[model samples]
Structure formats: structure tokens, C-alpha cells
Target: MTPNAASPLPPPAERRRLRESGSLTQDQLAKRLGIPSRTVNAWESGRTTPRGRKRKSYAALLAELSRSAAKVTVSLEKRPAAPEPAPAAAPLTPAQTFDALYAFCAPALVRQAYLLCGQRELARESVERAFQLAWQRWPEVAVDRDPAGWVRASAYEYALSPWHRFRPSHRHPEPPPPDADDRALMDVLLKLPPPYRRTLLLYDGVGLDLPETAAETEASTPATAGRLLHARETIARRLPELADPSVLHRRLAELASVERLNAPRPPAVRTGGERRSRFWTRAAIAFTVALIGTTTFTLRTAPTHYEAPVPAGVQVQGVPPRVALGPLSEAETQLRTKLRQAAAHGPERLLPVFR
Candidate 1:
């Protein structure tokens, strides 16, 4: 066997099995191997045999991917059965449990958030905030069926929050990734609605199954399928070169890895959460005290009874306008002369004739 002599290819069925185990589509593997999909299809279908360095390279790549897949399987298999009430060893303390969880999930979560929002600092911030909240709710998190999922949901929410647009620091767009393909992918991703973007990333980029993706996205299975399909279609439309969704998936992973996003140490996160909680608690107590003081002061100094307040005076109304008298009437003049003679009497006035 010379360096150019390639080992016999696996049977067609085994070829498909290895590819599927690695969670790779034919187009993606073809792209990675820098060959056409039809060539890969032919090789997998047992239609052709090419004896050269290419065969050796293809077989080696497949072997590498298969080993990775196997490792993942073994790790999953090693997980303790969920129903076990107690383990042989004493249960880990809350801090240990939280730290383990944070270590396991935070790095990937930060990368995912960065892809979601395209902001490195914001992505780290979102994951930190999510872990902080998780620590505060440790009892709930500890007993959760999927603690990673809980933290992931919180991180995604924070990263994609519309309210972030109002933040002064986030007002302008951050610089895009340096590579052209990465820049294009980020632009397309940011254009998608939050739900569709999240669905696509979870299903394709994170390699989650349909049902798991649906559960994480909080959508019905059918709805999740629809979103995933539409998201692919939209991205394909925006970037015709990425019409093959397998390429899109590969590109997504590449883009996420391009940034050196990292999560803070778990201890720092835990302490930060404690400090934030304390500040809010102290603020709430101060507000309550101030409210109570104001109420007591108002009660002590308040008037004893409901004294009616005097209303402000209004201008007088109903008086007729004055008019000048031109001359005295004839009857008014005769009455005045009679009154000047001093002959007016109360008996005459009461029973006076009608003269």
C-alpha cells in the first residue's frame, strides 16, 4: 500500500450512517471536502471509485467526524439516570451545581447569543445576566428537567430584547465580522424576526432535533417547522449563494466560532447577582420607609374635622343699568307740591280718595 493507495470505501449504507451520525448533510460534507455534491453522492452510492489522495482525505475526514460523534454519544450515555432519587455520593452543594452548569453552558450560550444579536459585549452580558438570574432562582433551576435550556431561553431573550435598541450604548450597530461571508450571514440573520432567527439557529446551528427545537422556542411542533422552513427560505432569498441549507448551517457555526466570545468566571457571576439583588432589596425597603413616613406625617398634621372652605367672592349681578330722567312727570310734580304743603297724613294715605 503506497501513500496514494486509498483503503476500500465503506459500503453505501455504512457511508450514509456515518454521515448521519456526524449530523452532516451531503452538501455540507461536499463543501467541506471541496468537492461537488454529485461526486460525493456517487461515492456514497457505490457508483464510482477514485483511487488517489482524495479518497484518503475523504475517508480520514469521515473518520474524524465519526469519532467526534462517538464522543458526544458516550458523554450523553454517561449522564446519570434522571429518576435516581439520590446518588451514592453526597449531593453537590448549590454553588458547585451552579458552577458546573455555568461552566458547561455559558461559553456556547454566549456564542449563540452573539449570533443572535451580533454584539460580542452584549452577548457576554446576556449570558452573564441569565446565569445570575439562574443563581438567584437556584432551587427552581436545580430541580429543572433542563437547566441549560432555562439559561438558554433567558440568554436569548436578553440578547434579542427590543428594548436594547433604546439603550444608549446599543444605539448604533456594532462593527460586523471581518470576513465577507461572515458579514453577509450576520446581516441576513439580523434582518430576520427574532423568532425565526432563533428557530433556525437552534435547529440547524445548534443541531437540535425538531421537537427539541420546538420546545426551546416555545412553539408548537408544526409552528416550529413552519418557522424553520420560512427562515431558510428567507435566508436563501437574501443570499442566493447559501441556498443550500446545509451550507447555511456550516456557515452559521463558522460565524459563531469566528468571534472569541467568553463567559466570565462563575464566582464573579454569583457575586454580581448577589450584589444586584441586595441593591434592589435595599432600594425597595427605603421606598417603603419613605412612604410610611409620609403617611404618618400627613395623618398627624391633618385638620381634625372637615371644615368647609369659604369660596371666593363673585361680582354682584341682577342690578338694572342707570338711565337719566328727562323731566318730572305731571303727576309726580303735583304729588311733590302736596308733600311740600306738609298735608300728607297716614289716614289719608291709607283711605285716600281716588282723586
Candidate 2:
């Protein structure tokens, strides 16, 4: 039997040709697609496939680019051909890969989580959990084309879990007393839909390039750009001071920096041993409960004896009323018999002399 070879979806050559036809570099195409430049490179190099919705979107985008290219064929004829993509980098050691990633990305991910969850502890928990998962699956993650992106996506998902919403300890942190304009901007930003808010945060707050922002938000570059634009316009209407894009970006960066600085230390990652210990602890509790239940049921169904209580004033008789006491010995019995005989015979002739 032979192993199956992995093939790129939508075909790598076609993707490259479509991108080249549009006179777009890998970075430019990545921005348009709302993904990382590395991701675009992977697609063109046949290292991976675009699946699900991404696959459909990639196909549609490629077709559109091709059509647009056809309309301007004359103008594009003089451009130089794109160079062939380089080969994939060798895989990094799991420890080195994970350590580097954690050092570089932990703070940013924590801030992102905090912004989404609005609770200090929950945000830290979300980032810790994400990193723990990445560590556990280091073999896969270390080799992944975009490990940072993978971690970011995982952290975002964890932060958005519904469990966080209902937690008793979850509470919004108090903002530093802001001036009127800052307060208004915050109010409007908080009201924006999650997608727009996240897009703006990644683009402006984190200073990610358009393509990187899209990659983080799982949106296309164009869509991410549109979201950023809309969010800015919305903010501008509420606070005219942020009307300039540069001012808004700077403000967002400052806010993100503050959040990062204020974020609590990341929670300790649970080791495999710790996770096993937790599982066993829970199992022991469950077993104890079951044992108690079975014992209680057995006791409830067991037969019991009941006795009647005596009446308050009634004297109970032990022996029958007509019955006489028995003699204590054989001699006593014989003597009593003789005495009775004598009494029967002498009843007529009884003359008594007292002594």
C-alpha cells in the first residue's frame, strides 16, 4: 500500500498565476484575502490546502482577479514575471518553537483576550489555556506554517466561550477616569459588533498590517479594511478628536499598551500530570457519591421488626388465675399427696387436743 500525497486545493500554480495576473505581490494578495503573507506563500507553494469557506472564497477571488486581469491585459504585458516561490523552511524543535512563540506572543494574546472578555482573570485564563493546548500539541503546532496565528485563533475562541459570560467572578474592570472624548469613544467602540471591534483592535490597537489583522479576525483583508473604516467612522461621529486616522491609531495603540501593562500574569499551564490528577480527583468524588447512594438504598429496603407498647394503667398477669404453684422437689410432692389423703379420711373423726 502507498501513502497518499497531499495536494493543494484550487491548485498552487493557478493561485500564483491569478495573483501574478493581477500584478499583486504575495503580501498584497494576502491583504486582499485577509490572511498572512506566509499563508499565501503556502498556498502558492502547495504546502497546504484552503478548505471549507476559505476554499470557496479563494476560488471566487481568483476568478475575479483573472477577469480583472483580462480587462487590462495590454497594460500588464510589459511587467516582469513573478519569481518562483522559495521552498518551505525546516521544522523547528518543539521546545524552541513553543518557547519563542510564548515569549513573543503571550502579552499580545493576553491583551486581546482581556479586551474580548473584559475580565482580568478570565482573560489570563484564556491565554494560559491556549498556550497549554499549544504546548500539548507542540508536534503539530511547531510544524504549522503560522504558529503565532494558530495560538491567537485558539486564544480568541477560548475568550469567547459562553462560560465566561456567566461566571460569578466575571466583572468589568474600572477604567481610568477618562475625559469626555475618551469616554464617548469607548462607549461607541464597546457598542460595535464583535467582528468590527476585533478588527479595529488588531489593526489599530496592535499595529498589525491589514493582512495580519484579517488573519487574526478570520476575515479577508478587504473585509477587515472595511470593518476598520466603518469602526473609525463610527468613532469619529461620537468624538471628533479621533477623526484623523493617525490619531485614532495612536489612541488605540495607547489603550492596548495600557491593557497589556495592567494584565495579570498568565496562569500556570497545566501539565499532563496535573490534568491527570484533576481527572482522578473528580473520579474519586463521583465514586464516593455512588457508594453512598448504594448503601442508603440497601438500608432503606431492609426488613425491620416492630413491637407494640403496653397500655398505661393496665396490670398484666404473667400466670393463669386458676393455676397453682408446682412443688419444688419429689419429696415435697409425695408429702403433699399424703397430707391430702389423711385429710380426706379423718374429716369425720377429728377431735383436737391443744398442746
Candidate 3:
């Protein structure tokens, strides 16, 4: 029945905006309000909200910040026309839009990927590859409901692909996490099946609701929930300290934070994607041309008529092989020669040379 408690505070984005505009770090705000920074993060991330006295303090702080931002906005609007008004900014082109998306989502996706696959290089590579794919399919992705989720799914799939283990670079294991506990936690995570691992990350680490996690994992809600529970239980059995979801969430985040992962620049990713696209495109054209050429050569060189193969020679059962004949007797030979000389109209030369 209190006024501050009765009124709703800003939405998640606005709360973050107000805090940022007020020039207060989450740590500073938490210190001033005597709350954990994690709680502040959760609220800003829309994962949780403060309650009781903390809610009131947080709400009042945001309202003051909002009012101050409003005054600044008004003053700026009133004072700001240049001698010549500036031209309106142009809308972002697809490339610019794609680049912006990459810059915004790549870092966090890389960290998420690290948690999905323990290899640091693979984690970074997967995100970059995902962004590349997004750029290639920019039109589709731009119109997507959740572009970040799309990119995240791509990255996670790549990082967790069974094929990656067979890769030359992954033939040997990378160095283990510096902290023994982190290494153990990572090993435990890696031990879980990919579906369960992804489910846990989507639900616990990324804060997706069960249905969303299920949809993303392409599983029924029940199946997704089961996987999540099983994954958590397995981890807890190995690492009892992470039995609680909240602690596990925080620990997973900490694990990601400790890695030295950095994604390539957006322009580089875009360029790489374009180059890859061109390579494939050209390769396709080349393949088509070669196929056409091969087809033409085949058509030209192929036999027009089907020539039946010769049958194998076989002996006739009813007949014997003929004996070799000797030359005719001398008189017989002479008679045959005389007959040929007297033959028909003329000799062989006058016979029209049939050839």
C-alpha cells in the first residue's frame, strides 16, 4: 500500500538507460543502495527484480535519473539548431546494419560459445563464422524475430559439432583452465551430451525461459526440461557447489568471463564472408562450365551407332578342322591361268577398276 511500491518502474532497457545516463556504474549504484551488483545485473538483464525496500530505492533512483535526462533532453532541443540545420541522417544500408548487429552480438556470443565448447579458439571462430553466415543471409536475418538468437544458435552448433573434434587443431587438447575449479567445472560441462549442455546454457546461463530454450533446441518442452534437469544433476553430482541454479548461473558467467576470447572486427568478418561467398560463387560457375564442357565432349566423342561386341570363337561340334591344302598340280595350275587370260571382255585393268 506504499506509493513507490505501487508504481511500476521502467522497463529493463530504460532502467539500464537511466542508470547509464545518471553516470552511475552498477557497482556504484549497488554500493549506494547496499545490494549486490549481480542483483543489479539481473534486474537490468530482465532476469529478476528487486523487492521490498530495495525495489523502492531502485525505483526512486531511476525516477531521479529519468527526470534529469528529461531536463537535459529539453535543454538540448531548445538550444541546438546550427546556423544551417544539418541534413537528416540516411537510413543504414544492409552492410552497415549487418555490421552493427555483428558488433553488438559477437562478443557475448563468443563467450557463450566458449561455455558451449571449451576450446577458446573454436569459441571465437564459431562466432565469427556465425556472423559471416548472418551477413551472407543478411536479408533473411535482418527480418528475423531474434537475430541474436539466430546467430547464437549457429555459433553454438558450430562449436559443439562432433566434426570439430576430428579437426587437426583439435586433435590435441588445448591448455586447461588456469583455475583447478574452473577446469573441473569445464570438464563436467563437456561431459554432458551436447543437447543437455546447450539446454543448460540456454536456460541457466542465457536466461531463456523453458519454452524458448525448447524451441531453440528444437525439442519438446518436456524433453528440454528433462535435459536441463539431467544436466544440472550431473554437474551437481560432480560439483556440489553448483547445485543451485543461481550459483550455477553466476559460476557459468564467471567461467566465460575468465576466458581470453575476442572476436574479429565486424568489417573483417563481413569481408571474409563476402570473400567466401565470391569463392563459392566462382567455384560454382567454374563447376558448371566444366560440367557443360564435359557433357559437350561426351556428346561429340560418343559413338553414334551401338557396335555389338564380337562373340567368343567356339568349335563346331559336328565338323572337324579342315586339313591344310597343298598347291594344285602343275597341269591344274596351268589350266586356271589360261582361263583367266581368256576371261570376259578384258583383263583386270579393263574391268573398270572396281575400287
Strongest candidate by TM-score: 3
Superior by TM-score: candidate 2 or candidate 3: 3
Model 2, span 211-322: residue lDDT tens: 7778777788899889989988898888888887667766764554554434333233536424855788999999999999999999998867775787689666885687
Give the runs in model 3 whose Cα sits over 4 Å from its true position: 1-51, 54-86, 306-355
Best by lDDT: 3
Give the Cα lDDT of each candidate. Answer: 0.87, 0.71, 0.88
- Give each model a TM-score: 0.64, 0.48, 0.70
Where does model 1 exceed 4 Å of error?
Answer: 1-90, 308-355
Worst 10 residues of 2 by lDDT: 1-10
TM-score of candidate 3 relative to the true fold: 0.70
All candidates in order of TM-score, best leading: 3, 1, 2
Error of 3 at 170 (Å): 1.4
